[model samples]
Target chain A: QQPVQSPQAVILREGEDAVINCSSSKALYSVHWYRQKHGEAPVFLMILLKGGEQKGHEKISASFNEKKQQSSLYLTASQLSYSGTYFCGTERGRQGGSEKLVFGKGTKLTVNP
Target chain B: DARVTQTPRHKVTEMGQEVTMRCQPILGHNTVFWYRQTMMQGLELLAYFRNRAPLDDSGMPKDRFSAEMPDATLATLKIQPSEPRDSAVYFCASGLRGNEQFFGPGTRLTVL
Candidate 1:
């Protein structure tokens, strides 16, 4: 099943901050995050693995709660360029050890100037 | 600055037609993934390949949709007898590991 993202959409001003959450009903092996601007492809941000280290890039920080089967993305000092849709893809344990990713509906974030 | 590339950024076809979308994965990447995006359903995984071998395609409709990876660098998704409902954006992604995937610009499909 696909993960669920909260706050379907959010609007923020430049320099503001926002947090997007993702939750899965089943146990997630890992969570992958991406950002996609209007008419563009989804760009990889980072990944959080179960029992693994959390990662960050630039001003973006993310955390994964293995116990809660949830992940949250934190965007600090949001810029106009941060206006886009954020997607969280949850990976499930496969039969043959292959990885399959299921993406959420996406959280559309709009940062205005 | 390696990135996945998809061909025919846009494709328009009528119902009962065949639509084939191609993808060229980043060099040395052993995994390729295909996805379809629609307004209602969001992003759906159609299929993926590991080492040119199909890993899973249960998300794809076996009857009309087929995905194949000809080699390490190439992948293809074909829809036969496509209907208007099939119109949406298709994305191809590649990755060396399941931890992250690099997506292509995507192919916007419109079935009239």
Candidate 2:
């Protein structure tokens, strides 16, 4: 099943902060975050595996709560380049099986100068 | 500069026509995934292959959609008698098991 994302859209100014949350009904073994610019392919941001690992990339960071099957992506001091649609893909099952990613509906974010 | 490559970035066809999209995964990538994106559905996984073998295709419309990987580096998705509803952006992503996936630019399909 597809994951659910909160705050369908958000608008922020430069130097602001925003949080996007993704929740899955099924247990997740890993959570992958991606950003898609307008008229472009989705770019890999970071991946958070089970065991509550938090990852940071530049001003963007994410936290995974394995127990709750939820993940949150944080954009701090947002820059103009941060404007895009964010998607979270959830993977379920153990290692070595048909591990496919089920993506969320996506959160549209706009950042102004 | 390793990346996934897809052919025919844009396609426009009439209903009941056949559409074929192709993908060439990055070197040494073992898994390839096909996805469809629409305004309403977001990103939906259509099919995926691991090591040139189909692993899952439950998300695809079996009646009109077919996916195949004839070689280690190539994957194809075909739609026969395509309908307007099939108009959407199709993406191909390749990765190793349990690794980050690299996505292609996508094929924008328009069926009129």
Candidate 3:
């Protein structure tokens, strides 16, 4: 099933901080985050695999809680380039399911300079 | 840097026409995924292949949409008797097992 993302849209100024949350009803083995600019493909940001582990990319970070089947992407000191749509893909820990991802609807973020 | 490549970045066809899209995955990547994006449905997985074999295509429309990986490097999606609703940005992604998928510049299809 598709995951649910909070804050359908957000507007922020440069250097501001924002948090986007994704929650899945089914148990998730991993969470993958990507950012997509207008007219461009989704670019990989980071992935949080194990539960209770936090991963960071430059000023962006994410945390995954396996028990709750939830993940949050944190953007600190946001830059203008950070303006885009954020999507979180979840992978179920099925026996043979390797990387089949079910993605969320995505969060639209606008960061103004 | 290795990246996925897709052919015919834009496709426009009339109703009842046939449309085909192609993709060349990154070398040595065993998994290829096909996705369709629309304003209402968001991003939906149409099909996927692993090691040149189809694993799951349950999301695809069996009647009109078909996906195939004839070789390790090539994947194709074809639509027959296309309808206006089929217009959307189609994306092809390739990746290794348990790793990040590299998406190609999508093909914007417009069926009139």
Residue A110 in candidate 1 has what lDDT? Answer: 98
List pairs with backbone clashes in candidate 3. Answer: none
Report the lDDT of model 2 for residue A27: 92
- Computed on alpha carbons, the lDDT of every model, listed in order, comes to 0.91, 0.93, 0.91
TM-score of 2: 0.96
After superposition, the stretches of candidate 3 with alpha carbons farther than 4 Å from their true spots are A52-58
TM-score of every model versus the real structure: 0.96, 0.96, 0.96
**lDDT by residue (tens digit), candidate 3, A41-105:** 99889889864554436666888988899999999999999999999999897466656788999
Residues B1-112 of candidate 2 have per-residue lDDT tens digits of 8989998899999999999999999999999999999999999999999899898999999999999998988899999989999999999999988788999999999999
True contacts kept of 1: 0.88
TM-score for chain B considered on its own, for each of the candidates: 0.97, 0.99, 0.98
Best by DockQ: 2
Tell me model 1's lDDT, rounded to 2 decimals.
0.91
